[model samples]
Target: MKRAYGLGTRSVAVLLLSVSLAGCGLPRSGPSKSEILAGSVEKLGTTYIVPVDARVARAASKSPELGFSADFVTADVVGSDVIHPGDTLSLVIWENVDDGLLASKGVNATELQELQVDDAGFIFVPYAGRIRASGNTPETLRQAITDKLKEQTPDPQVLVSRAAGDGATVSVLGNTGAQGVFPIERPTRTLSSMLARAGGIAVDPETAQITVTRRGRTGSVWLKDLYRNPRMDIALRGGDVILVEKDTRTFTALGATGGQTRVDFDSPNMTAIEAIAKVGGLNTNLADPKGVFIMRDETPEIASAVLGQAGLRETQRVAYVLDLTQPDGIFNARDFIIRDGDTIYVTEAPYVQWQKTLSVLTGTASSANAITNAAGG
Candidate 1:
């Protein structure tokens, strides 16, 4: 009975130990409020500004409401429906059914005219010598022509149209399959429609930026906003060029991360914790959970500037090391935003690296031996 009781006590003790060990392996509860607040203060004490391209700045400088004015209309002419360059005409009697006036061939519906109005914003027509076309449309210009023709030709019937060359075109460049001049047919042409005509954005998702330039006025619009924000899709004008560029910059995150290898969040503003989640989350067995190092190009100049702003001593460097094991550490992860050229490194427990190295070596040796045997055979 004594022997049996002693054995039973040992078994119970072993069972309790096993249960305690199993509980330890389970995930810890999330951090508390005080912990998160402290982390936020430590991680995001200052604002970070990323450098934007010069073209981007120039593009934003112009007024959003640009080029919605006159001076974009065609000429007004009688029988000379077509507006052409260097065409002289004779304005004569119309009521005298016997006047030596001949009907001029009207301009075609498709001819694009490049008519230039004088300082008075008027085009010189045949019978309607000089009439304003800058702020008027074809139908409106026709009425003005009819009024003027009445002076020379009695009740002269004047037909007005685009007259000849009126349409203007602009170019679309960069990251597009088709790069060429796009004609401005309508008065208000949108940016989205233009991009669609140029064979849509790239299949592989990337950061997209568009630069618009017209009459020395320029602006840049983010590609994301072109779809998300309705207001960003502004009307385009003639002589405006659009250049769309892809987002190529990326940072790498490695070790015990959500993903074991490289994870491309694609933005410099990605936080350390966000990057980890993107990869897959921490590997329980291997992750140290405390030492998270964000290795960056901490040049002396940049380091000094950050340090000066941070009010840190010379001994301290800009490269930051964060601990996520402490309960409050999770909050710091949220506040810590990544920069353009940063490498996030999550260290592992001491045994983790050795185990990984051994696994890799074993696999390599096995492959090598198999290849050697195959060659001999």
Candidate 2:
């Protein structure tokens, strides 16, 4: 009976050990708060593995297409200050020899005529009749009038100048110090120049995003990029709407790292290394070196390029892994771009799970030993 009891006690200890090991293998009682906040989209269905090289290529390919056409930019630079319909012009007609209409006016062979271009794009000049002036530059209109007056007078000189008009204006809206319709005063008015005229960006320029909407299509560029790259400050069109807004691009940091929160991009070109640094890096004790992941929602084009298929919503959530254990992984992290709305997760190490199981087993063994000691006493 004593031997039987000894076998039962041994069996109980083994059973307890097995139970603790089983608990370790099973998933933890629900995901941690961090996990829920940055839950892996992989659970949704299909998750593609994006390599660092592939991610870099994808990021490089995401340059915003020009919203306005080349013709639009050229027009802004060339004809921005040109008089259009609804513009009033001060016209002075002078003749070297007093003759024709100015001579009849009896004013030293010169006449000052204030004329406004009609909606039909014509300005009525006495004796010169109706002249199309809407699309013509002031110098071009002056030449046109001179050519017409040559039929009646000798060497008639004409000066056409803009008196008043709804000058070339762009709507400057959103997070700007002053929001209103800012006139494009100069023919060479560029995006940066316009922003300056509108009191510059109200928010931090590093954290500001600029979007230009022309006609109906929209394109965006980082305000920081515009500051760094002068070429990106394209000329602003007359009707273009320039929106200077706070950067809404954010990524969630989760798992064995700093606190989980949606971290905003300080700049548009944020890499995985930068993102990790933003979140205080990984938890040294619990983080899995091989489990650094950046989860992103892929566009259909990206999904097709990476996963070989599209249409499946599940396939759109891609997980890009960067294993710090590999020698090249750190280098890859520097190149792997972290896109807007990505989730950065550093999973717990497998050894950490084993350690938890060991703790449970140690506690169970201590309890069993105490029971045995009490029974013996």
Candidate 3:
């Protein structure tokens, strides 16, 4: 009985040892309370922190004009509507009408006159002559032609058609794969369609802004606005010009990260997490969790003065710092977003710089030894 009892005791001890080792090998079930709190704090600091472009944000958020819903369409197409430049007009004469009566029967407008309206908004016709074609839709232009023909012949038949030209042409230029004029064939041209025509705004889209300049209109449309609301996909009228402005958002990043990098945000509303991913994720062994800063202009005083009249305050102008070290802080790291023109920097732990220097030295020494041996041979 004594030996049996001793064996039982040893068996229990062995089982306890196995359990201890298992705990060491298995992953933790969840983060501790402190980690959760840290993550929450970090996330709160990041989401509200935007870049220094209040002017741009304000401009983008402004309410669009009422009754001008980009989606809205009217059934009645008018004269001031039809055949503008950039519109393709199709002209068809009645088969019953003798060719003697219609001077230009069976002749295509494009073949005859290129069907282009000059900057002065007039298209040269064979008989109708240089008539003001701007703001007139096909039906209205046809009616105008009918009225003109009435003076020469009684009960004249006339047909006006919109061919491929004189509709809407948007110019996509600068850093685009295909930099040229893209004709907006449809009545309403969305921002997405325009980019497609321009070979999709170059690769990565970081350094691109679609600038829309109307021929006679004074104001231009911001490409970023389309991001906020697809409705900002403004309709393209005749002689509209589009510019794919080059990328301007750029910043330098350094410290415990994999490598110092220069990144581009292109435009606004690219969050912190996004910017970090662009430069490569944090170096697990080298990154120090506590140090991250987005550098911006120290122009709060200027911003406040400008906004003071408009009832904006200084408390609104501040950048954010994100801490990643504490396990709980990971939540904030994920939630905190960045905006356009914002820079993200992650600091490396003190030991990483020394390790990197040693790595370089070792590589150099190995190369030197290899070269010396090769020369001896």
Candidate 4:
């Protein structure tokens, strides 16, 4: 009976040890890194895993919505600086003698008159009557006045100059040192010059964005890009509204990275590698070399093209994988442009999970053995 009791006690201890070991080896509650990567390709849902390569990078880089193009900063449709409504013009008429209609009785035989362009686009003159000045340059108006006065006087000399006009004016608003209507007095007034006149960008120029609204269409370009590409500093036009905005696009870094937080791009065209570097790179001790991922939400058209699928719903989420262990991954990362509101996740090494599980089991086993030995004593 004593031997049988001893055997029963040993069997209970063995069963407990077996259960503890089994618990240590049990599958983890969450999906593994491999499983997550696999799900990216299987079309299990809206999530996709696209492998980064030269071909993939080239394709992805073609997205027009990702970055601003120099094409948008097109040549300013050059227009003559003609007079517009709500303009005040100063007119000077020099008559041959003091008997002309424009000549004052005793004021040096010359007429100095200030006239404003009416809402009907006409400016009143003594001999020219109500002449259309809205679409005419000062020189053209001067010639028109001379022609009109020719009927009354021989070779009447007239001068037309803009006192106050909207012809050379532009509206500058938002993050600028000065926000108001600025006149393009110089013939070579470009975007940069106008911005300087407006007291430059109020925010950090490196992270600033300038939006140019011409006519009814609006386009944006990064301030840094404008500085780098002189051509992008297109000539400014009348009625152009320039808005200086602070950089708002940002990406979040998660998992095993040096720092996990939201990172802002200094420019609109930031690459995946640049983003990683901005956050102090990956956490070498915990990061898996094979599991660098950029998670993004894509439009249906882009998602379909990327996943090679048809008839997918709009706004699909995808994970782009980059294996830093591969030789070409570095180059691909340089080419992979990071868009606004993207999440970069660096997965943990596979061994890290196993090691954690093993450590917990070892601690539990040691505690159980200590209790058992004490009981036996």
lDDT of 4 by residue, 100-173 (tens): 67666655345545688888889888767889988888898889888998888877888787754665678999
Minimum summed lDDT over a 10-residue window in model 2 is located at: 28-37
User: How do the residues 113-178 of candidate 2 rate in per-residue lDDT, one tens digit apiece?
Assistant: 668888887898777889998888889889988998889887788888765355456898999879
**Count of clashing residue pairs in every prediction:** 19, 0, 43, 1
Count of clashing pairs, candidate 4:
1
lDDT of 3 by residue, 1-377 (tens): 66655555555555455445543343332222233335432466422233223342332222222222322222122223355654545555442334534555553222333466767777765566787777787677778876775676566566665554545555666656687766655533655566766676664453445655554433333455555665555555546666666646566666545557787664454555556666777778866566565544324443344334354333343334566555645555545444444455565554554565555455545555555455445
The better-scoring model by TM-score among 3 and 4 is 4
- What tens digits encode model 1's per-residue C-alpha lDDT throughout 1-377? 66655555555555455445542343332222233334432567332222112332222112222221222211111121332222222222233234423443342112114446544556766545677665565567667867876677556665444522332456889877688776544422677777887887763333566777767756665576667666667665546788877655566776556554555445424666777777777778766676565655544344445434454433322335566766657666666666555666666665654565555555545555555455445
Q: What is the C-alpha RMSD of each candidate to the true structure, in Å?
A: 14.5, 6.5, 15.9, 4.5
Top lDDT: which candidate number?
A: 4
> Model-by-model lDDT, in order?
0.53, 0.72, 0.52, 0.77
Tell me the deviation in Å of residue 74 in model 2. Answer: 4.4
**Residue 51 lDDT in model 3?**
25
TM-score per prediction, in order, is 0.51, 0.69, 0.51, 0.79
**lDDT for predicted candidate 1 compared with the true structure:** 0.53
lDDT pick, better of 3 and 4 = 4
Give the TM-score comparing model 4 with the true structure, all chains together: 0.79
lDDT score of residue 14 within candidate 3:
52
